[model samples]
Target: MARFSEKKIVAGSLITLGVLFSIIAAFTDCSAGGADNYAHYNIARWAFHYPNLFLDHWGKPLFTILIAPFTQIGFFGARLFNILAGLTTAWICYLLASGWKLSKAWLAPVFVIFVPIYFILMFSGMTEILFSLVLMLAIFLFFYDRFVLSAVVISFIFLARSEGAIFLPIFLTALLFKRKYVAVPFLLTGFLLFSLIGQLYYYHNFWWLITKLPYVGGIGANYGRGSWYHFLEKAPDYIGILIFLFLILGMFVWLKKWFSSGLKLRSEIFTRLLIVAGCFWGYLAAHSYIWWVGEMSLGLTRVMAGVTPVAGLIALVGWSEMDKTIKSKIGKAIFLGLTILFIVLPGVLKYKSEFKADTREVVMDEVVKWLRESRNFDHRFVAHDPYFAFSSKVDAWDSRRIQYGFADFTKPELNIADSTLLIWDAHFSQNEGHIPQKEILDNPKFELVAYFEPKVPLKVLGGHDYCVLVFRKMENLNVDNNQLMIKLKDEQLKGNLVYSEFFDFEHAEPGKVPDQFVVQESDTFSNKCYVLGKDSEFSPSVLLTDSQLKISNEVSVGVEFDFLAEDQLGNNEVLMVFSVEKEDKPYFYQGQDVLAVDSAKWNHARYHFYMPEEVKKDTKVKLYIWDIQKKNLKIDNFRVQAYSK
Candidate 1:
């Protein structure tokens, strides 16, 4: 009875703390909407009116569905949902810790609340808090032997973020290891039922989700790819280095205890620990392949938020074990002081930094006000940031969809007619090849209408300067004549020309592979290049051998290619290659900078490659236009030249 009362007290305290924090979050206007937040808000707003609108594979449908009702109340309601989810997560963490009989079980809830990322996300209106809540609840239910309930919750976790599916295998394996054969079937059934529902409601087949797995895995690849050790490097920023060390130590200690016990300790607590450790390590391993994991600006820490509560619990376990093992009271006290300093100090500092008033709010409000005053309700707007669109209650399209190939801006099917407005900001421009600012600027269709800037200097963390430019499409503008174009004049070429090939396709067959070139197989495209706008995939590469081009000692070599592309959906890249073979071994090198060309026009692209004196004599070169996407393009002139001082 005493233990039951103690558990009840702990639960009550956690609930109270969570509610208090949430109320504080509600009153505080310190929240900032990120790209993900804007996407979530837009999806939620769309869900309020149209049930079948969210058919895209990229949308996290479950989040939008859950938050749709609250979105009518605007950002506050959306943030309130997150706040409640965060508080519930804290309560769930305490329950799990108490069930496991961990020392200082109440501390688990405090840990969840104190984590800076969790605190910040609770107010920012992102899915992390809600996702973490469902995830932890699933774990807690599983430990309590509620297999079917756990399975149902697990399905919701999967819907929250597709990555949550990674936990499914681990959960099933734990059940199998424990000889719970019936539970496995129940879990599988629940998973399939949820997946089928998603397919029906989203109007997509199973393969739609399956095919997007690779795309999700490769997200942010163009920005940068991170090494496997990215998590290790960023650990200090997310959680202090000292606390991270304790977490690692706890894992080692847990392993030693399990192995020494002959691996037969199948207690519920031990199983729970195994599951948590599996999830913590599993998320790190899976995210290592993602390009955004390496880019701190892309929210690498936020990606790890789901597993942070488990880590904190594990670290506390390690700290308790170490405290008990210490022989000297002075030493134990010193260790405790240092641990407190590491864990609490950093979080307090981070909390202060995060809770500051987000200055972007002012700029966003101003832009929305201007739109409401200047534009009619029927006017369509295009913007990278959806917050302005949602706030102003105007029909808007996200430019990112076009940049990422999810939608084509050039296609008339999108309804971007004359009088449409285009808004661009620096934050969205950082993603290379995705920013269509230049295209919008170059086209005479869009004329600059207004530029909005923050009246006061904003110092929000990870905040960029406010430069929101709005452009309105001109009436009766012909998109064909004003299509995006790239031009390189003859004067831009550097050094003396040695050889040039003007490819007029005179000797080459019209539909067949060109002479001196061979087709390379690609999953996205079949042929490298043919007649422009043909059905052939344009990303194919053709190799050239040493017989085609002889290399001489030259300080620099330059190559220029003339190409035409039509109806380009995404970023198109062309590559220039150089190679050498030594002692039957081949060495190949390519130019560093890829020439990016605009769609629906012809381009004269130039690139230079410098050859060292040592390798120039035996070097053999190969040149091919490497199309990054499988868009239709035409090649006319292929020119190569050598240059010396």
Candidate 2:
């Protein structure tokens, strides 16, 4: 039999390099993932004091408990905790690879360390690395013939990420098929412990464990989903292109062999497929399904970091296949050289920004710093993305010191005390907080206190301009924004509509495209504009490219359209997108399901947006609709008007 252990030098070097990179990233890079990352750190930091926070479904219970001690020092401590977890994951990955007696198995650690998003996330306070570590370790334990321990560890997958429950079947099948009946009972170990703890918290009144599940809402449009192949499309961005390609190839080669070979449950290759590759692809497929169905999954590629070890393992398998397929020693050397060259250098470079400090967080840091130095501000602040809470050393759960309203602060149930300071950011506030800037601005009770624009104009993902704002609530003073808006509209309309046009379709022909609305001129002759609109990739769209608006000053634009869908809309939505882009990158972008109707009826929808400062005179702006389900529809009275801001 081939030796299972890797060379001591190879092991030490891989371990050392992984540790060094994680340490450097943890301290040096200020940005990681979004609010969830900071929120996880906060939960871990304070879970001991607020014992319920340990069971806080959003922050995985086991993750909180394990990481709590480390987080006492600061978020850096939690980051260090992840570093350990990540290193442990790499070690287990290396062990599994070498134990399988794969050639050049030292590449496993290298693969895990350099996976772009995994590299960044492993050093951050996010739960993905830890979650990945636990799953990977369970298999490692099983590999060592610790069947009961493996079952117990696999059960704890839920306490890391809720979706991890999906992997429970893999172990269940393995244990049952292997006739390890005792190990099968151990699968409930994690749930039972958490249940007891939750029972204590609930005073034994009800099943707090079930009630506390964050994703209990079966399937609804919480965060609208995307394509079924979303993960497949985005894997390269998460893992580097070399790993992504290798991962694909690994799945093909591994699955091909697994199916072709004997259908024995106790085979060695079955173990490899079920644990390593199974965890990776199974996760990818599950996430893809949720995202496709418009379930709770937001379709973030960062979630892939949780399965980084398995992904790296699969990629290594692919590398081994490449080795086996090429019999010539010289040819194998060249291929290995190419793999090393490509993986070491860069093929997926778009994700490089993820390694650096996110400009959004950097800009928010300035805002928080200013708030700290400028005046004596109350810790009782209202904000989305409890970033302020973390930075100010305020306990998020201590409502006495802080009025922290997460997600739905706009709702009346979430009462905000008078004279509260609010930090309304563009990113978290718009997406997770579900509050628009206009809502805050229009409210008479709140006054815009400060606005900090970055020194250099910058835009983050989703075209959110990097601008942090500060608002203060004053109950004593008030002004009628409704009256102000009416007056402003009157004043603007009295002047002139910068560019007002309406497509009534009365003069349009079925065979002819609308005037000045064709997206591609090459296909205009062949495409049909059914009455007045054509919406294929090669056809016409509602493009506001007229020079009339170009010469005008900054203005607020409102687009109202009448729509009638031929088919009922299910989870899909009639997405109307209003965007302003420069050089193909959007400067301002907003998509609304203006007509989310089940029946075929004429629905009048109004969507409004202000022209961002990023929009230049020569910049291209587009206003379009995306029928996600491709429901053929009739649109009429499509009108757009812009008035000076």
Candidate 3:
């Protein structure tokens, strides 16, 4: 009892230290990567408003719930949660160490402190630390014969990260060494009930535990079939050659003793060793991080967070059997040396960064301000680093845009013209294919209005400096093109008659329309306008000839038609006839006009002709369309109507 009490105190101290450091780190400027922290913020908002949809991402609701209150208070709160969770994870590691009867309980805290990647992840608002804590607690409870507590803790671990389910079979296999018959039923019942009730009913995963097996299995298959370099890289760094050496030597000693002992004691030793070894091997093969860079401090921290418990268990078994020889003391020295090596390296690295004090950073303050000022309920901006904007109350793209790694601006769905401002980093573009500067400038429909080089470059994936680019729709700008025209004709008019020729409306063609206007030249073809009127002599011509103001010397004759760009039904010329004479008499008149479309049907139009209230035999009229721009007169569809007085 005295020994147990001492162990608990030591373990508890280690846990407290780790948690305290995590809190301090969180309060510091510890936001590392972009995407994961962004995901935390997004999920927090999602869960706050629609908690029922939590199943869409398995069991991230716990994380969401934890983040909700912090997020409400701003970034400081979220940062604090990250720190607390990281410390809690270290505490769980200490608990596992105590359970395994490891002598140096401080190893867990050292591992957390020295691991650089772990430090980055600690304050990044990611799930790694939270998941690690739950895993440690579940395993500790399982070994303590608290099956119900173990099962609940395991369920929550799985909830934290879908990959946590892989540990279930490993836990069951470990139990085989502890209690043979009990292992089978306990594992089966725990899993079946968890799946049936927690996953299927409460979590809404109908398939339960069985559904989770494939994902775990796939992780194992990937490592077994993947590169040997991957194994070598992650293996030695976290599993430290010294610790494994101890594990192996301890295992041999236990096995030899088991062979010499009587049946019952032998059974107990074998079961304990089997559980410890099986879990170690199974996790190595199945955990997703197996292929990650184990050499990095962060990677080592993650591995040790879980692996230390197994090492501690094996060390305990060896301690029970040792004779306290000089060699045993040397081994202890080696283990302590390894712990110091990991912890000191990271602590030193942090100090080194402090010495440099030249970290480049983005000033997201202006960016966030713009988003809040510019955003509406309906408008969403496509910023490359949307996470920062999202954290600031600005609406951003959906999951489709977030697919893969960064933002893809070229997606056609992003073209809606309701003030679409593309904020991009120039360096980001360079990495993305060096999108041509001319491509944006030459766009007829988009005009670049603003560019800003952030005081500090944004830390984006693919390692590029980032900036903001703004563009506006080109709708309000008038296009100066006397480069467009139209013609109409019909051979059923007579006398001093002239026709007003004009096509009405202006804009792009809506939907699809039959090619009605034939252009005379190839140079006139454009995606904006379909050519229908050609320059064929007999094709269609606008003509004007008239003498209305008592032989006021026949002025030049001309004609013009409105460009049909309105709705397909509303896009036709209205033929209007009016005299250019000083007197309100007819100078010339063309009868009702007809469209000379390829198909002999009058598609759509309204007509106005100037005939006297009572036609005098001598009433004269001139015909022309009112000059728009240059006031060019036009005549076509030759015909004259004579009403005798």
Candidate 4:
């Protein structure tokens, strides 16, 4: 009776946890996979209206079709679709664990739910969550002797993600070993079905599948490559160390089992080892090679989310092996408690660290609001960013409001309508769309109307300020491209000292950086401040210590400092950089050059910078003055004051 009661309690607990996660995820603006999430969601959101987008290659037709109905209601509805798939995947993991005769089968859901990257991707519109559910279901069916069904289901894998093509040969080899020739034909179901449906676009071209491939290009020269251990190193970051340790243990167990029988492919073992474990290792190896060779795609850790379900199984195997050793029931309970804590803690910490909404989204929202209020706000726009379209409520199907075009801006003479706004961003427009900024800058047909840049910058690697340049196609240019920046301000700037300090080194510790810097020095102060002499080994720099930099795009910060190049170099001026970095990623940058007016003289220079916004979202704001040019320079009585406009 106690065992039955425990089973009911466990089932009810899973249901409750799943519902809670769903509700929380719906409201959260956490990104699934950056720009790709919005790109995929936009396709799914509008595919119902156009119908042609159901066959869009870049959008991943299967993913678009699967989530389209939910997306029709809203992006939240689309999130719920992925969330439902996630919860169902957890249930499948539970079933797979129970079927494998694992002692702690109930821990399967817990393991799947807590995978750090997996948890994040499950709330997004990306194809990974559903792909995970589909692939895992295929594994379960294959193991249960539903050979034809498994093949039919696995056939749709490629439509979910381009990586699915890599699995076809391995799957075919497994089918051949098991002598399931009947199911072999069914493996092409997804390709054949989609191909037949895509005939309308292809104009009866049977070779449309090969011709319309989305990711068919060669290696990108600048996308960067990684070693084989790239994913291995980043594994702990995405899956957390607890799952990573167990994953290594699980792989060891599987490899041991595979080699114990001298590479034998027994029918019973083939399903689990050849297919299940094969998918796990196969997916990992392919990605490792793809990144290692610097090919088709860059090494994005989020791609691993697609195979997280299988990794969860391997993790479960590792946990099961460890669970077997604890003889005491009390010890086992304690172990279970710790496992949950370790798995969940990383995700919770990550959630707390990241902003509720990404800087890109925040800035894009502001840009859209600004655009709506501007002159000719209703004029047609040409933009590459999917988020901009979503924010502007521009129907991609209707090219009147906005044209989803690119590469057109590369031309010197654009044929766009007069007053049409070409909204270009530093991201998609520059990278994927190949819209060269220099061409637009040189083009006379385009007029720089409004420029939008974020205050708080994106903290991701290879991130940019997400500058949205609003240019109007004009016969006669109104504004100079060189002076596109127009600062908006009231008559009086708001006096708000987010932080202020003055350091003259009057009471300074010798050979140490200054602190607080509040001691104001009167005239006739000592000349004992920090200095960097000619050919000095170390650069004496001013670092704003423990300052909560909450400056925004509208905030104006005045920087003042006393400097002297006692023995000034031959035309080598000190380039002082007042940089603000978050997590070593320098996003907000404002700098100045201190050219010595006269040699051996202390020159006082003052400058004000309009800082970007919400820098407080970072772990730490490093506002420091550095001698980037490394010229012989002296600095003292440095002061920084911030005010809002």
The prediction achieving the highest TM-score against the true structure is 4
lDDT of each: 0.60, 0.71, 0.45, 0.71
TM-score of each: 0.64, 0.71, 0.52, 0.81
Angstrom error at residue 218, model 4: 6.5
As for model 1, its CA RMSD to the true structure in angstroms is 15.9
lDDT of 2: 0.71
Error of 1 at 190 (Å): 5.1
Model 4 clash pairs are 455-612, 455-613, 456-613, 552-612, 552-613
Error of 2 at 598 (Å): 29
lDDT of 3 by residue, 1-645 (tens): 345565466557656765665556544654454444665666665555555434334336556656677766665566667666666666655666556555555455544433444555555566666666676666667667776566566655555655556777666555554554444454444345545554544556856445543234321222223343443355444444444455566677767867766545326455555555555555555543454423211222353334444554554445434424425777868755755674556443543342211222244445455545756223334444435455455432354223212233343223345455544445333334334333544444454544443322244333343444444444554422111101111111123432333322123233322224332322222223322222211213223323322222222223333333121211123233445333554444443233333222223333333233343444445543222222111222232332111
**Model 2 misplaced stretches (Cα beyond 4 Å):** 1-5, 202-206, 216-221, 325-331, 347-350, 406-415, 453-467, 480-645
| Clashes (candidate 3) | 36
Is candidate 3 or 4 superior in lDDT? 4
Q: Which residue ranges in model 4 land beyond 4 Å of their true spot? A: 1-11, 200-203, 218-222, 259-262, 351-355, 458-464, 486-555, 558-624, 628-642
Ranking of candidates on lDDT, top first: 4, 2, 1, 3
In the range 108-173, model 4's lDDT, one tens digit per residue, is 887787788888777777888888888888888887889899898889988888788777776788
Candidate 3 vs. true structure, TM-score: 0.52
Question: Worst lDDT window (10 residues) for model 2?
Answer: 520-529
Clashing pairs in 1: none
Give the poorly placed runs of model 1, Cα more than 4 Å off.
Answer: 1-4, 30-33, 53-57, 189-191, 198-208, 211-223, 265-273, 292-299, 326-342, 356-361, 373-378, 395-407, 410-415, 429-435, 453-466, 476-645
